[model samples]
Target: MASTLRFSVTFLTLLFSLWVVEVHTSRKLISIKEEEDQTISHLLKDGEFDDPSLYMFFRINDLKYDLKSGSKLPIFFNKDDPQKLPPLITRQEADLIPFTTSKLDFLLSHFSISKDSPQGKAMKETLERCNYKPMEGQLKFCGTSLESMLDLVKETIGSNADLKVMTTKVTVPTQNTVSYALHNYTFVEAPKELFGVKMLGCHRMPYPYAVYYCHGHKSGSRVFEVNLVSDNGRQRVVGPAVCHMDTSMWNTDHVAFKVLKIEPGTAPVCHFFPLDNIVWLTK
Candidate 1:
């Protein structure tokens, strides 16, 4: 009977130790997973991660993390200084980052205005008049998406009495020689209605060829850049021109174009030509 009691006590102690070990392991795994998620969230908030760039960056870094099974967690070490780990950007802080000309320029510089063109003239005029404040109030009729802006523009122009606007579809070739058809708007009597509006000029750039123009208005000259490609390549940038409105308001126009390129390795490299020296947005 004494022997049996000893065995029972020993068995109980061993089971308790094993249980404690399992609990410790589980907690450690949970902590590591939380850290991994925080890291990814921070990078995304800082605009460091996106479609093509994110994929390439991850592959190049050889980052390995298993989100499933909760066994392994991805660790993010600072690329510049491996010893320091940065805190993630909070939701409130992320909201403070204005999605303005500066942000857009950093993401993509191919679709921008040249200082010499009429469109550039308009952009400069508007920027000066508004003192570079972002668009707000009743003048805040701009759309965030190209499709939404185009629809709004079509409706606005269609209701206008002085302007005769016609929306047409056109096919343009990108630098990679791929073709795409997109909606283009032509405003007849635009000069009479929009006195300062004019086709300033057009130019091209490598990887993505584009033409920009300035449309005059009471607020300022609205810059428009059209993309001339449709190959659906990896680095496709499709959006409208960025506009500076009077009263320190900045808005973008839907008159932007989409760029597509041919498949890689199949076509010869194409060089893009720069437009005449034009004013550029400053830091």
Candidate 2:
């Protein structure tokens, strides 16, 4: 009977040890995940530019819409080869799989992402945003392929119109956020043109394949080639800035209002485009 009692105690002790190890392991994993998230947050800091709040006093002009919202979309730039962008996939290839929550299981399986994984959650959010309706005077479309995006741009601006594509050029290699000043602004396509610079802002979405959330803002928007220099004078990036003249349709609580110290619909809101974003200007 004493031997039996000893065996029971031994079993209980073994189970307790296992439970303690499991808890410790779980906590360690959580800590590692939190640290990773914080790192990404630093990389994706607001406005995609350094010290965006200072934009109000720096180089304020007829530039258009603010892209400095708190969206975790993506912060990384294209692999320095903006010209050789993701190729055009077939229409059937893009249409075969839908980006919808109802097909979450299928979509996750197609992308080889576990439903409970962080990537799966990101894909879900992208799907939801794509499905949402466009804002007032806003033209929104999700292009699964580069061809589709270009086609939409030509349709909106005009098939016969000449075009110029501009992307944010990042010179720094480190992951740290660096401050930059707008040295000067040059209009690639002015708002006063006949087509009024039919601008299309295409932002890259997180996906197995290249997906872009392309939207064209209404008139009263201007596209500019902004010359930026880092505060340390170590990095220089010639990026595109879009300014929205019509803020009446913008949300009252947009970050631009707070940064500029003005209410929405009162003044123009303009922000520098991120590294991966594409700004299409029609000539």
Candidate 3:
């Protein structure tokens, strides 16, 4: 009977040890699953652009912080006059404007395409084979201008090896903050010569990307749309964006523009805009 008692005790001890091991393994599996979910959230951090085709960019549109004196102003043009001129921005005044961009640098780029790599070689090759026949009755740029633009790209883009030389961190817009600025705009039409190719209009939106202080929590919400009256009295509106520059617009009724609220499901092209700021965009 003593031997029987010893066997019973040993069996019970074994059972307890197995139970402890099972519980530890279950907890470990749960912890690993939780860690994987966190990593995914980290990779998709910050804002998500609504249209993936427009290109990824970083923007600084906060109005409170003073811009650095040496920061270069974004290129923009006035559209009200017949001459179609770009508005001038001095470095000092540009500092007060409260806007910055990384959009132009990636006009036709992908998130995976880094500036410090030779991947641009493929783009150059594609350009070489690009069908660039000028159309009838279209404004044609001089061959010299076309050649130079392509040559410049071949010489400068994607020639480097390592991209980690500079660190790129995501800029998170602050919640509930307001922004104000002069909504400058440019107008343009595609010529028959460059009908298919994507180009930033000289008088249109020189900087198509923008940001505001509100609506920072949502992934891809835009603050406002810009509008202008055509010569025929028709109103023209650019969705999710407007350019600000020409001081002449305020002086004359020739340039008609209005700020329209963007609706849900529309692609707002701006990178920054406000959410629920009890504020005004007068400037």
Best by TM-score: 2
Q: Whole-model Cα lDDT per candidate?
A: 0.25, 0.56, 0.23
Per-residue lDDT of candidate 1, residues 1-283 (tens digit): 6755664465455334322311110101111223353433322232222221121111111112232322211211111121121222333443443334444333233336565656555444433432343233322132222233323443533322222212112223344321211111111111111234321111111111111221223334333332322223212222222233332222222111101122322222211112121111100
Model 3: per-residue Cα lDDT over 142-217, one tens digit each: 1112223222222322222210110111111343211111121122231111111211111112221111111111
Estimate, for each residue in 141-192, the C-alpha lDDT of model 2 and write its tens digit.
8878666776777787666436566667655456544323232222322223
Q: What are the runs in model 2 whose C-alpha is more than 4 Å off?
A: 1-92, 171-195, 253-262
Instruction: Please estimate how well model 1 matches the true structure, expressed as its whole-model Cα lDDT.
Output: 0.25
Best by lDDT: 2
- Backbone clashes, each candidate: 14, 6, 17
| Sort order, lDDT high to low | 2, 1, 3
Q: Give the winner by lDDT: 1 or 3.
A: 1
